[model samples]
Target: MKYYSTNGQVAPVSLEEAVVKGLAGDKGLFMPEKIATLSKSTIDGLKDKSFREIACTVARAFFGEDIEPDTLDALVKDTLSFETPVVPVRKNCYSLELFHGPTLAFKDVGGRFMARLLGYFIKKQGLNDVNVLVATSGDTGSAVANGFLGVPGIRVFVLYPKGKVSPIQECQFTTLGQNITALEVDGTFDDCQALVKNAFMDETLNNHMALTSANSINVARFLPQSFYYFNAYAQLDRMGKAGEMVVCVPSGNFGNITAGLFAARMGLPIKRFVAANNRNDVFLEYLNTGKYTPRPSVSTIANAMDVGDPSNFARILDLFKANEDVHKAICSKISAYRYTDEQIAQTMQTVYSETGYILDPHGACGYQGLIDSKLTATETGVFLETAHPAKFKETVDKILSSDIEIPAKLQAFMKGTKQSVELDKDFVGFKAFLLRQ
Candidate 1:
């Protein structure tokens, strides 16, 4: 498959090129030239396929002859080494538990897939000395750092807001030494993201070094996330509990829900989806009004979604701008809402009281969105639990007055080494770091 820039000014690129380049030369997220639809039979048959097999089928359909079948299979095997189960927490609300991966966060799916795919492409084409630039609110830096760590011929530089991320989240990224390095920027996620984008858009930087992205803005980082929507549907179908489902996704850069929009386009039987956000509720306003206006990001407890101007909104608009049919297909099945830290904490308390489920602040935001929407019981609600509760152990412990066990994967991470730099969240500091690299 080939991809072109949304602005129609860039050369079309092969799948490998798109994965490696991340953004088009004209500064657009590389969208698939075509989105393939899954037949009804294919959707029905998905129930029987293992997560790896289904992922292989979906990825192979897009990758085609570019990636060998065995290679894709092995990539899926290594990436999805754990399960993404939809655990029930209430009569209709389900937690689409995505922390089952190595990093105990949903970004693990995209991060791992993108790293290996980039690795595959680089190895196949004999490309070397690539640099991956990424921005993180909280979980993304750790996930990307861990995902691309020690991969030959590639170096990962993760920039995160200095004091915003949780201590564990910061440690997870900074501790992974190898080819991974973290930059603690004295600014918000938007600042980090801006610096990363500026580096990519810089002509001098492009000439001196090959730069790519690991943010959800990257098509490679977004596509694999579609797998869990299918996985959730299949799980519900197998248990004879399938219904018109509304998935509440904690939206930051909007890539997660955009992935779901891609799946629904492929004929998944989803009723609607909620793009839940924290204080950075730019998307929430857009869904309510047709106009999209961005503001500065605000810090909140659900730190991951603290994005004021989401980069992936461009991709979302591109998906909908094709035709009326495409627009209806995507917009009809989507909605958006925002929550505050107080609301998130209250919902976390309510869920723990009612369901004995301790949600991290992010998951609590998703749950709150579903409740605020008053989704019907028949319309099952599944909140995307993007990270482990233990990642926010202080809040979780305070709310429930109990300890949440850290998963084995995180335990292993705690044992590994880390490397990082402290820098002011300024373009000069970021540019200096790039020049050194």
Candidate 2:
């Protein structure tokens, strides 16, 4: 399938070019020329399939045109080795637990898939020195770093704010030694994202090395995320409770929710969406007033949702504005809500006390969104539990006043010593450093 730049200035390119370039020459994110819809029979049959089978079916639609069927099946199966189970949290509310992969965060699915896909492309094209530049507020850095760790012929540079990310999130990336470099930038998540975007646009840097992003801007990274949504539907269908399904995502860079939107567009039967936000509520502001004013992000308990300028907003805008009323289309399908740090903490505490389901700070935003929206009695709501609570051990412990046990997977990352290169968040400094490397 041909992928075109959202900006509409660049000509369409093949899957290989879109995956490799990550961003378009026009500085716009890539969008597929077509979104394939699954037949009713196929959608109904998903209930009998495993997560891998459901993913393979969904994967074939987005990727089969570009890849041989067997090869694509293998890639999908490998990327989804773990399951994203929809556990019932309340009467009709569920938690799509996505923190089951190596890094135990939602990005693990996209991060791992992009790593393998990029590896395949590099080996096929006989290219070396491919650099993956990612900027993360939290989980993304750990997920992408662990996903590409020790992968041959690829180097991942994780740029994150110096003192913004939780300690566990920092450990997950900084401790990895082979083929993964952590860049602790002295700025916010937006600053780190700017440095990565600028690096892609730099003439000298591009000439020096092959550069691509693992951020949701890359189709390879975000498209695979649609797999779980289909699987979630299947899981709900099997339970005989696949009523009006509404998904609430704790919006960060908007990649995760954008992927869900793509699933809905592909006829996954998603009734609507709710975007949960923390203090950085630019997207919510956009939804309320129909004005997109990007601003600097503020620190919040839900650090992962601390994105002021979400990169995938362009993709969402393009997806809805395709020959229709843009604001009306988006507003109709997506409800927006924002929460304060106190509200997030309160939700986490209340959910734990009432249901014994531990809500990560990010997931707290999602849970609260559904609660605030006042879902219909027949609507089945699933909020993405984006990461394990232990990733934010300090915050969780403080909020609940109870010590939570860290998972063995996270403990392993913590055992390793930290190693990172600190740099000023200025683009000039970032460019000079990349050029030297």
Q: Pick the candidate with the highest lDDT.
A: 2
Cα TM-score of candidate 1 = 0.96
TM-score of 2: 0.99
Q: Write the per-residue lDDT of candidate 2 for residues 1-437, one digit (tens) a residue.
A: 89999888989999999999999998999999899999989999999999999988998999989899999888877888789999999999999999999999999989989988998999999998899999999998998898898998899999999999999999999999889999999999999999988888889999999999999989999998898899899999999878689999999999999999999989999999999999999998998898999999999889999999999999999988865679988999999899999999999999999999899999999999998889998999999999999999999999999899999999999999999999998898888888888
Q: Model 2: which residue pairs collide? A: none
Estimated TM-score for each candidate: 0.96, 0.99
Writing each residue's lDDT as its tens digit, candidate 1 over 74-191 gives 8877888888998998778789999987778999989998999899888887988999999999998888888998999999999999889887787788887779888888899999
Deviating ranges (above 4 Å) for candidate 2: none
lDDT of 2 at 392: 95
Clash count per candidate:
3, 0
- Local error of candidate 1 at 216, Å? 1.0
Q: Over 4 Å off in model 1, which ranges? A: 324-331, 415-418
Give the true-structure RMSD of model 2.
0.8
Candidate 1 has an lDDT of 0.85
